[model samples]
Target: MAVLSFDNVSILQEDVPTLQQVNLEMNEGDFAYLIGKTGSGKSTLFRSIYAELPINSGVARVAGYSLNDIKRSDIPFLRRKLGFVFQDFQLLTDRNVEKNLSFVLEATGHSNPDEIRFRIEQVLAQVGMSNAIQKRVHRLSGGEQQRVCIARAILNKPLLLLADEPTGHLDPEVSLEIMQLFKQLNQQGTAILMASHDYNTMRQVPGKLLKIEAGRIFPVNSLD
Candidate 1:
């Protein structure tokens, strides 16, 4: 199965349609860019895949869950298959980077001390933050913090990584570094679907591009 998908899915915010007849699929090892103006349904589509927003019409099968009428109990399972990265770091201010990452792994059922330590080290290495694990959240730079967030997201070795404007708060150089990290993860068969407005970042790297506008999706470019 494709890692993530939308089949004629439509989303509504009260009476307004946020997405219209959307149909798309992202395969394992695939990397794609999703872009549009603000309020153009970029987040609406992303949220729909994670079942954050209920589908008003059509069908969507995401992370192996039938989001059309998914059960509440099924949500946790679905979430485990996806690594969601947000623009905001959302780290625990009171905890160091290691503790913040450790909390999620334990909350998600990684209890072995050896395994937990190994998992933390592995993800940190992936994001080039092996040295920042012991640093307090406030002490790291904005770019480094965001990298930690990405590391936390992938600690479970998720099947798909969904990032919504992952680099919105970083400078160009830091943004490029973050994007390259994502590219590396995708190369290892972790499907990636990123939503962003940075046209230059997407241009330099290679990926399929889907543009969203006025509640619709379009294929503006493809480097597959």
Candidate 2:
């Protein structure tokens, strides 16, 4: 089944249309790249999928929820099925890595302390950050911080992962490490839809391409 689908959908930010008549689909275990120039509606489209931005029209479904008709109360449930990684590595600066991750678990209704710790360990291990559990966010390198962000996102075992320029700030070597981590997650049965500006990295780790331009989305035939 498709983890995400948008048919003739329009995305709007603050009542201004950003993408029009967008049609797309992502299936289970599918890994795809969302490529576009800045301000070309890539982030807006991502927001629409996660219901951060309202769908102005048409059919949209993600993680088995109908986005167009989703109620406010249902938004949380919709988000639970999605793991979002952002470019800025939005970790809480004041908290240690474990606390940051624990906050997510607590907010998501995970009350059992033992289970929370086990799950946290599992995700941190997945991202190769098990050793940084007690480190403060300020002390970790940018790549390590991003790994924490990824670990936090996967705490719920989301059906799809939505990443917006996850490697935008790191050096090429660090960026490659993060990409390899993402590829590993995709191989382990999670679908990924990542928005990226680094065309070189896209070429190195090729996948289905969804290119957005002038408020439209279409598949690219080749990276060349």
Candidate 3:
């Protein structure tokens, strides 16, 4: 099954067309890289996928939710099946790591205390942050914070992960480490569509290539 699909979709930003007649698809467990210049439609496309932006035209579906026809009340449920990671860690800085993660569990309808604790432990261990569960979010280094963000993203066991410049802020070494972590996640069966501006770094990793230019998106064999 396709984790995400867009057929003849057009996306607009403030009445301006950004992506037009876009056709894309990603099957379960697929890994793809979305690359484009700074004013390209990458962000718009991501927003549309998560139902933040309205589909101007055409059929769109993500994780089994129809985008063009998805109701407002169902958006939250649609989001529950998908995870988002941004370049800037979007955690609650005042909260400790455990609090931040547990908040997500509760919000997503996990009520059992034991179940929540087990899920948190499982994700933290998967991201190599099991030891920092009680640490405050503000105290973690950039890499550690990003790891925490990844762990939080996966806490719900999403069918797909949307990452926007996840390594844009880290140093080269740390960025590589994060990329490896993403690779690990992909290998374990979660589909990933990552948007990145750093072509050199992104090209170093192996995945299907996609580029947005001239107000549209299409597959690419290489960055060159």
Q: Which residues of candidate 3, in runs, are more than 4 Å off?
A: none
Q: In lDDT terms, which candidate is top?
A: 3
Error of 3 at 156 (Å): 0.9
**lDDT (C-alpha) at residue 132 in model 2:** 95
Worst lDDT run of 10 residues, candidate 3, spans 197-206
Per-residue alpha-carbon lDDT of candidate 2 for residues 52-169, written as tens digits (9 for 90 to 100): 8888899999999999889999999999999999999999999999999999999989999999999999999999999999999999999999999999999999999999999999
- Per-model TM-score on C-alpha atoms: 0.95, 0.97, 0.97
lDDT of each: 0.87, 0.92, 0.93
Give candidate 1's TM-score: 0.95
Candidate 3 lDDT, 1-224, residue by residue in tens: 89899999999899999999999998878999998898898989999999999999999999999998899999999999999999999999999999999999999999999999999999999999999999999999999999999999999889999999999999988888899899999999999999987666776777999999998899989888
Q: Model 2, which residues run further than 4 Å from truth? A: none
RMSD of candidate 1 to the true fold?
Answer: 1.9
Candidate 1 Cα outliers beyond 4 Å, as residue runs: 222-224
Top-down lDDT ranking: 3, 2, 1
When sorted by TM-score, best at the front, the candidate numbers are: 3, 2, 1
